[model samples]
Target: MTGTAKGMIGFDWAYCRALAVGVQDGIADEDVERWLPEARKVHERILKERESGLLAFWDIIEDEKVEERVLEIAEHFKGRLVDNIVVLGIGGSALGAQALFDALVSPFYNLTTRPRFFVLDNIDPLTFSQFLDMVDLGRTVFVVISKSGTTAETLSQFLIVKERVVSLLGREALKKHFVVVTDPDKGVLRSWVRESGVLSCDIPPGLGGRFSVLSAVGLVPAALLGLDIRELREGARAMAALCETASVIENPAYCNGLYHVIADLDKGKNIHVYWAYSDSLYSFADWLRQLIAESLGKKVGEKLYGPTPVKARGVTDQHSQLQLYREGPNNKIITFIGVKSWPADVDIPPAEEESLADAGYLGGKKMGELFHAEQRATAWALAEAGRPNITLWFPQVTPYTIGQAFFLYELQTVFMGYLYGVNPFDQPGVELSKKMTYGLMGRKGFEEFVRYL
Candidate 1:
């Protein structure tokens, strides 16, 4: 599990070693050793829970029935000429799909022969209005995703899109062009699926939206875009299996979780900054932000504790934020993500033989080399300044690697929750805000909150 392709991804905390007690604000080797048993205990508890069929997300990746169902539906539409694939979702529903599509597919995929993919995660009137104007309703396929079928943003978006689809393609075309992925038997979305007779998929009962990426929530969209959905699941399955073991050293998920929790609890470094060198991974970083923020940022009893999670794109953010990161407060634990190989590369054209002789060093290097070099420099510079950092190196940015990364972080954040003594699955704080919005909007039960506000 430590090799290039065999492991798919690697985590190195060597640079963080300098943060030992005497050197700087870092967790000592002895501390990591002390926490190893604690981490192992958490792992053991998770395994026990999983063994008794108590954990859904832990085993959701290996659900063959869901995979087969998703692929069956995907295969049915595999060869259909879809000019546009509109995904109507928000939060976990939309972010994971967008992250996968951006990371594995081409940046200019829509401009090319592939079907243009758009995830309407927001309800900006002008945005959806513009989208409706740009694509022909008849040739587009609408994927309306909402586990509850009652999410305000998603339902609103589906309504708007459904109207246009019915108006343009006629009422008969709704069942053909619309695909709904929600709860299998419950929720308003499911009722609509049955009445409309449209193709539909399940979000799996007990599966939280943020953690449902590997389920049909993510696979359906990935398959629709021609990505290797099975490979993605295989990658997640591999990581999940490795995580079942009690040894943190052998399990990247455990190791990641330990370091993040240790950095926050022991090192006083409360800000977790993720620096992704690949632009394709930037959205993946966004997905990470939501996972960490919503899951770990919580209060238990009389105490409140959670680290702030931040995202930065390497080489790009190097110019914009590196100065502050280097000279400003040392309250951040940075994780630098780098790709070992890119699918494509473009070397500098020898500086045109005469331009910027001082810049000649970059002449023979590929653009990717510069990207990698800047990450290395940033890590080195940060460590020199006594800033603790770690790296999650990917052998390549493919569906397999992306899938592995997704599980790795998901488990890590969950472990962080256990360490912080909070219920990671529930977001009561966010629900309060949702209640406020519902009340403000004249929802019956939330009227009290609206009046108070």
Candidate 2:
């Protein structure tokens, strides 16, 4: 097939090279490449396995039924005169979409135009109270998203907001006020939706919450905020095409994944520093942090290693963290993310002779030139310190670049998961805290906790 056709069909050669390099580095087995030709067979096996129901779930996500349901939710809100949308969700359900919303949408989109969007993903009482106090209940809509529909933080906030909506708009207004996006067949959320008469949408089965950004969990809020959902899909589709290929060197995802594997397996670099030059991408770092942490953190045989630690801090980190990074243990792989051209730039003219003499530096260098020089110096210093680094330079910061960047990381992460020999799609570790919190809450049933002073 032609490249475009093959890309559309999800064939990626670069990702295959990534898988191979990962294997050769002893991070995971080389058999991953052998499984490529039988990719469909492997997918079928995943669909049949009980634990692999996630595969079947994701398969149905692109189905007409799911898309139609998402559109319905969008239409329902669009039909109403809602002025605000408060999304109550936590962790995966909230973070990815929130990051995209914040990055891609104009700050003025909500304030001057359509329904303003606010995310209440935290259980902070003060923040929740402030949010409610600011929004007008008469024109506000609440979108409660929990893949399982029973997340305590979500449900608790939902209950609080529901009571307020009922009080201000009355019980009859509950239908107009609340909507749910969750698992269709299972979970207490479905039962609650049925009993409460709130509109509901399904969270696809195989797609884990973290990976559900392309699904309704993400798209619904995105659409509400006037984002181009098609572009988002096209970007993901493009990345998927990149992931399914055979040649590794040509794929950005494979190269990134291979570098990570080599850093961890060969160089014993366990920490991955994601250094972004933009302040806007700080949250993007957090999203990457979760993606890496949850995907490769499983115990394999006697070894319990996860994907290398992914930390997202700004270029400003050079002033502080750069010291330890340069002089400390050689256990980190620094990835520098830079934009080739910033939409905003300030040029500093040549300093006056007196000022130049006082500073003991060049008299005529522009401020931009000085900043670039400093960045180059830091990069050189790190290299001199024997610190391996990779630089991803973006042409500019736009939706297209952002989309491509997101997909690049996602593809690399998936390959990294495969290389680590762990189920990157599922996060069994997150349940521990949820279970603990529920046990402590004494809600509905279960054991009581004793508090010692």
Candidate 3:
């Protein structure tokens, strides 16, 4: 089944293509072949670690308890006549949900029938004020997401909003306005939910924040936006089946990882540009940037190499950054994501005879053809310039494709982390800023700053 799917997707020769290209570019092609079997072994292990029941991939979806809880939360909000949903989170908690929402939902997402969903994931005071200004407190609902239940930025924002809601709608409004998603039985937020009588949901244990999107972390917003959460889960399940196979060349994740590893470790390309052809997918790029950076960035030995740089959504950026990419430094890898199909509602007519004569070019090609030509030309130019690049061609930007893409990149990141000898599951570097901020807030030793104040 996995082989059939790979063949259907034209991914059967990816490993061979990667190996051939790696050798031609004078990168360590032998390492790829030698590591191929090991990569497959590790991927299988990961699949087994997550497999349970009918879901071919991770057990998170198959867990009756988890699904029941998610549905309960959805029902709870649905029955309460909530009109607005404000999600308070940052990084993984926010990015995945926002990206999925933007991709799968309408631009005017809440036009008539659905509850409007808003994300407050950053710490911009102006933005928070703007959000508060727009919504009616009497009809709003807040979904607070913090795995630790004590993320300072998330908590700070939550407190400000909570206070405002209390002031406008009174203490009784708390039950109507708030629900918490945090660690199952831990964290300050969980305790607060218990004491304050706000409903609570659990972020699955052993699922790191970056990887929790398919879990309730992402699905809650997805449900609110009227997307088919079950289809997304099914797509993930399909991907999980692919990961179980023991052939590196046949596995999309393995081949992708091999390409990334060769580019970064062997070819000295440290920066990664995830360039997408469509404006709608810009959020997807941002979501992937966080996933790759947070998962792979780590200092090993005396060197300070991490996934330090990521740029996204090209064609527009082609005008701005293409010059630097082509002529500047040989320190980056470009990954192009192209959608192979479009809605029938969008169309562009061929050029007329007069227009063709003026331009001195072909007259009967579709506009999409021209755009794809430019993309192909850019790929050739980058390849000719000794810049390593890869392209992921999706059949279309539906939930199924998005699910496959997300899982593909995520699994690739895991393999890349293993190749780099870093623990992909934990992020220690993110804690540094949090600890420093707490210390600064505590007034424990601010004498140095006191003079300036």
- Model 1 score (lDDT): 0.82
Residue 313 of model 3 has an lDDT of: 64
TM-score of each: 0.96, 0.79, 0.87
Q: Tell me the tens digit of each residue's lDDT in model 1 across 1-453.
A: 253456478877877765422345676777688787677667777778779866667677878998888888878787787888879999999999999988987888888855789999998899888988888887888888997777988988888888877877788999768889998889888998889899999887777888878888888888877889888988887777666667777777777778778778887788999999898999999998889888888888878878898999988898898888878987888999888888799978666556578788888889888878878888988888888888888888887878888888888777778767787787788787888888998878988888667
Per TM-score, the best of the predicted structures is 1
Among these predictions, the greatest lDDT belongs to: 1
Relative to the true structure, candidate 2 reaches a TM of 0.79
Q: Which rank order by lDDT, best down to worst?
A: 1, 3, 2
Question: For residues 136-232, could you state the per-residue lDDT of candidate 3 as single tens digits?
Answer: 8888888889888878899999899899988998898898888788898888898888889887778866777788788888877777556777777
- Cα displacement (Å) at residue 117, model 1: 0.3
- lDDT pick, better of 1 and 2: 1
Comparison by TM-score, 1 against 3, better one = 1
Model 1 lowest lDDT segment of ten: 18-27
lDDT of 3: 0.72
lDDT of 2 by residue, 260-311 (tens): 7766766577888877665556666777787788877887778886755655
Q: Which pairs of residues collide in candidate 3?
A: none
- Rate residue 1 of model 1 by lDDT: 29
